[model samples]
Target: MKKLVVMGGGIGGVASAYELKQAVGSDHEIILVSDNPWFEFTPSNPWVAVNWRKPDAIRVDLDEAMSRRGIRFIHDPVVRVRPADDQLDLSSGTVLDYDMLVIATGPRLAFDEIEGLGPEGFTSSVCKTDHAAATAQVVEKLCEAPGPVVIGAAQGASCYGPAYEYAFILETELRRRKVRDRVPMTFVTPEPYIGHFGLDGVGDTKGLMESELRERHIKWLTNHRIDRVESGVMHVTGVKPDGSDAESSTLEFAHSMILPAFTGIDAVMGIDGLSNPRGFIPVDEFQRNPTYANVYAVGVCVAIPPVGKTPLPVGVPKTGFMIESMVTAAVGNIALALAGEEPRHRATWNALCLADFGDRGVAFLAVPQIPPRNTNWSSSGKWVHLAKVAIEKYYLHKVRKGTTEPFYEKFGMKLMGAGKLRGQA
Candidate 1:
C-alpha cells in the first residue's frame, strides 16, 4: 500500500488530505502533520483581533477531526524536509517516509525582515489566532485611552486582504466603543495605490476601497516604504510610481498592526531548485514541484510572482478560492498518478475574496487570478459582511467534519459561475 503524507494542517493541507483519502481509497495510508494541535479559521482572524470572535469559536481539534476520516494526525513540528530522500524529520525525533507528499505548511510570517514589527516588536498582528486575541486585548486598552492608530501591510506582503479587513474591523470596534473620534486612524501600504491588493487594483477595487476608507473617515498612504519602527513611531518613505523618492516622514501612533512580508517555512526553504530565494516553493501549473515529481504544494507555501512592478514591492494574493483550486488540482493529479496515468490537472487559479469591515464590506472576483485575465469585477455592500461571517462558519464546520468541497460551497460557487481546478490535458 502506498503511503501519502501531507505536511501542514492549514486549509490546504487538511483539504488535500481529505481529497487524497477519498480518491486513494483504503489501500493507501495518509497522515497530516501540523505544528499546532488545533486548526484556526484564518479568514476570521480580523474579527478575532477586534473581539468579534473568540479563538476557540473558530478553531477545531485537528487530531480528532482527521482521525474520524481514517487519516492519521501528528502535532509535532517538522524539523527538516529531505526532498532528496523523501524523508521528513519531526521535532519529536520521528522520521516519516512517504511515497508521495503534499506540502501546505503555509507562509512563514517574515516578521524579522522588518525591524521592530509584529507581536514580538512594537506592533500587533492578525496573521495568527493567538496574535489576533492579543490584539483584542490591546483594543480594550486602547478604548480606555484612545490615540493615534496605524494599520497596513509591509513591502512584499502578498496577503493584503486581512490588512484591509483589520483596518475596517478596528474602525467598527472603535466606533462601537464611542472612541472613534479620539483615535485618529491611518492606513499605510506598499502598494502604488490604495486597494491594489497585490493584483494591480483588481476591477475598480482601487475606487471601491478608496471610497470605503474615505467614507469611514480613515486616512491612507500608498507606495509607502517602512524604514523601521521605533517605540510609538513608524518611519516611512513615500515613493513615486517611478521608484523615485517622493516624501519621508515619521508617524507616531499609540497602536499599530502592520502585516509583514511572508516567506517559506524553514523546513523546506532553500531546497535547491524546489524553492525561490524567498523560500516559497516553486511549482508547475499542476502544483507539482518541477524538480521533484513526487512533491506537490498548495496555498501560500507556493510561489507566485508579483502582479506588476511598483516603486515599493507588492506581491500578488492567493485568495481562499484560488487555494482551494490548487488543492483540487494537486490531489487530482496524485490520484491520476496512482492509477498509472500521467499527472494531468490544471487549476483555474481564480480568486474570490470578501473583505469585511464589520457592518459592510467589499467583494471582488478574478478569474484566472493573474493579470491579462478574462474576468475582473468588484463591488461593495452590507451583504458582503454577512457573507464573510457565513463563510467563516461554514469553512470551520467543514474542517471539523473533514469534508472537503462541501456541497453547498461547491454548488454555490458553481452557480455563481465559479470553477475549481480539474483535470484538463
Candidate 2:
C-alpha cells in the first residue's frame, strides 16, 4: 500500500485526508501528523473570546475522528520536512517516509516580528482557543475598568474577518452590559479601507462596513502603519488619502487585540524548493507544488501575492470556500494518479465570507478571488446570523462524523449557481 502523509491536523489537513481517502480507496495508507490531537473550528474563536461559545464546542478529537475513517493519526510536531528524500522528522526523533505529501500545516503567527506584541504583552488575541480564553479573562477585567479598546489586524494580515467580528462582538457586548459610554473603541487595520479584506475591496463591502462602523459609533484608522505598540499606546503613520499626516497618532487603549501577520509554518518552510521566501508554498492552479508533482499545498499555507500595498501590511485572503476548492482539486488529481491515469485539473475557487456584525452579518462572494473580476456578489442581513449558526453546527457534525462532502456543495450551494454545478457534474 502507498503511504500518504498529511502534515497538520487543522481544518484543511483533516478535510484533505478525508478527500484523499475517498479518492484513493482503502488500499492506500493515510497518516495525519500534527502538534495537537484536537481540531479547533477557527471561525468560532471570536465568539469563544466573548463567552458566547465554550472551548469544547469548537474543538474535536482528531485521533478518534480520523481513526474511524481509516486514517492514522500521529500527535507530534514536525521538526523538519525533507521533501527530496520524502522523509519527515518529528520532534520525537522519529522519521516517517511518504509516497505523497500534503502540506496543510496552516500559517505561523509571527508575533515576535513586532516587539512587545502577543500574549506576553499589553493585548490579547482570539486566534486560538487558549489565547481566546486568556483574552476573555482580560476582557472581563477591562469591563469593570473600561476605558479605550483597540481591535484590528496588524501588517501583512490576511484573515481580516475575525478581527472585524471580534471588534463588533466587543461593541455589542459593551452595549449589552450598559457600558458602551465608558469604553472608547477604535479599529486599526492594515487594509487601505475599512473593508478591503485583502481583495482590494469586495462588492459594497467598503461602503457597507464603513456605514456599519459609523452606526456603531466605532472610530477607525485606515491606511495607517503601526510603528510599535508599547504600554497602552499604538504608534501609527501614513496618510488618509487627502495627503495628511496619519503618523504619530498614538491611540491609548486599556485593552487591545491586534491580529498579527501570518507566515508559512516552520516545518513546511524548512523544506527547500518547496516554499517561497515568505515561507508560503507556491502551488500550481491545481494546488500541487510546482516543483514537486507529488507534493501539494492548500489554504493559508499556499503563497498568494498581495493585491496591492497599503500603509500597513496587506495579504491575500483565503476563505473557507477557497480552501475547500483547492482541497477538492488536490484530491481529484491524487485520485487520478493513484488510478494510473492522467490527472485532470478542473477546479476553480472563489471567496465567500460572512462577516458577523454583532446582531447582524454581511455576506460577500467573489469569483476568481483577485479583484477587478466578474460574478462578484454581496448581501447583508440579520438572517445571516441564523445561517452562520446553522452552518457552524453542520460543520461540527460533519467533522465529528468524518464526512467528505464538498464544503461548497453543503454551505455554498446557492452561490455556486448552475454553471459551476454543470461543470463539476
Candidate 3:
C-alpha cells in the first residue's frame, strides 16, 4: 500500500488530509503530522484579538477529529525533511517514510526580520489563536487607557486582509466603548496604494477601503515601511515609486499590531530542489514540486510571485479559497500518481475574501488572484460580517466531521457566481 503524509494542521493541511483520504480510500495509508494538536479557524483571529471569540471556540482538537477518519495523527514538530530519501525526521526522534508528501505547513511568521516586532517585543499579533487571545488582553488595556493606535502589515508581508480587519474591528470596539475619540488610529502598510493588497486593488478596493478609513477618521500611510518599533513609538520610512526615500517619520502609539511577512517553516527550508530562496516550496500549476514530483504543496507554504512591483515588497496572499483550490488540485494529482498516471489537475488560484470590521465587513472575489481577471468584484455591508461569522462556524464543523467536500466551491461560488467565470478559460 502507498503511504501519504500531509504536514501542518491549519486549514490547508486538515483539508488536504481529509480530501486525500477520500480520494485514495482505505487502500493507501494516510498520515497527518502537525506541530500543534488543534485546527485554528484563522479567519476568526481578528475577532479573537478583540475578545469577540474565545480561543477554544475557534479551535478543534485535531487528534480526535482525525482519529474518527482512520488517519494516523502525529502531534510532534517536524525537525527536518529529506526529500532525497522521501523521509521526515521528527523532533521526538521518530522518522516517517512516505511515497508522497503534501506540504501544508503554513508560513513561519518572519517577525524576527524586524527589530522590536511581534508579541515577544513591542507589538502584538493575531496570527495564531494564542496570539489573538493574548492580544485581546492588550486590547482591553488599550480601552482602559486610550491612546494612539498603530495597525498595519510589515514590508514583504502578503496577508493584508487581517491587518485591515484588525484595524477596523479594533476601531469598532473602541467606538463601542466610547474610547475611540481618545484613540487616534493610523494604518501603515507597504502597499503602493491604500488597497493594493499585493494583488493591486480588487474591484475599486482602493476607493472603498480609503473611503472606509476616512469615514472612520483613521489616517493611513501607503508605500511605507516600518524601520523599527520602539516602545510606544514606530520608526517608519516612506518609499517613492522609483524606490527612493520619500520621508522618514516617527509615530507614537499606546498599542500596535503589525502582521509580519511569512516564510516556509524550518523543516522544509534550504532543501536543494524543494524550496525557494524564501523557504517557500515552488510548485507547478498542479501543485507538484518541479524537482521532486512526489512532493506537493498548498496553503501559505507554497511560493507565488507578487502580482506586480511596488516601492516596497508586498507578497501575494494565498487566501482561504485559493488554498482550498490548491489542496484539491494537489490531492487529485496524488491520486493520479497512485494510478501511475501523470499529474494533470491544476488549481484555479482564485481568491474570495471576507474582511470583517466587527459590525460591518468587506468581501471581494478575484476570478484568478492575479491581475487582469475576468471577474473582479468587492462590496461592503453588514451582510459581509454576518457571512464571515456563518462561514467560520460552518468551516469548523466541516473540519470536525472530516468532510472532504469543498466548502467555498459549493457555497461561495453559488453565492458570488464567480465559479461560472472559471468555466470561461
Winner by lDDT = 3
Kindly list the per-residue Cα lDDT of model 2 for residues 1-425, writing each as its tens digit.
Answer: 89998898877898999988887857899999999889998888888888888899899999999989989999999988888898999999999999999999988887878776788777789878889988888788888888999998887788888898899988998899888899998998878888899988877889888988898999998877667889998887766665456656788989899998999878877566799887999988778888888898878898988886565558988888888888888888888777887768655768878888668988777777787667566667786677788778988888899898876545666645533323321
**Clash count per candidate:** 0, 1, 0
Q: Candidate 2: lDDT over CA atoms? A: 0.83
Model 2: number of backbone collisions: 1
**Local accuracy of candidate 3 as per-residue lDDT tens digits, 49-83:** 99999999999999999999998899999989999
Model 3 TM-score?
Answer: 0.98
Candidate with best TM-score: 3
Question: How many angstroms is residue 85 displaced in model 1 relative to the true structure, after the best TM-score fit?
Answer: 0.7
Q: Is candidate 1 or candidate 2 better by lDDT?
A: 1
lDDT (tens digit, per residue) of candidate 1 on 240-288? 8789888899989999999999999999887898788899999998899
lDDT of 3: 0.92
TM per candidate? 0.96, 0.95, 0.98
All candidates: CA RMSD (Å): 3.2, 3.0, 1.9
Score each candidate by Cα lDDT. 0.88, 0.83, 0.92
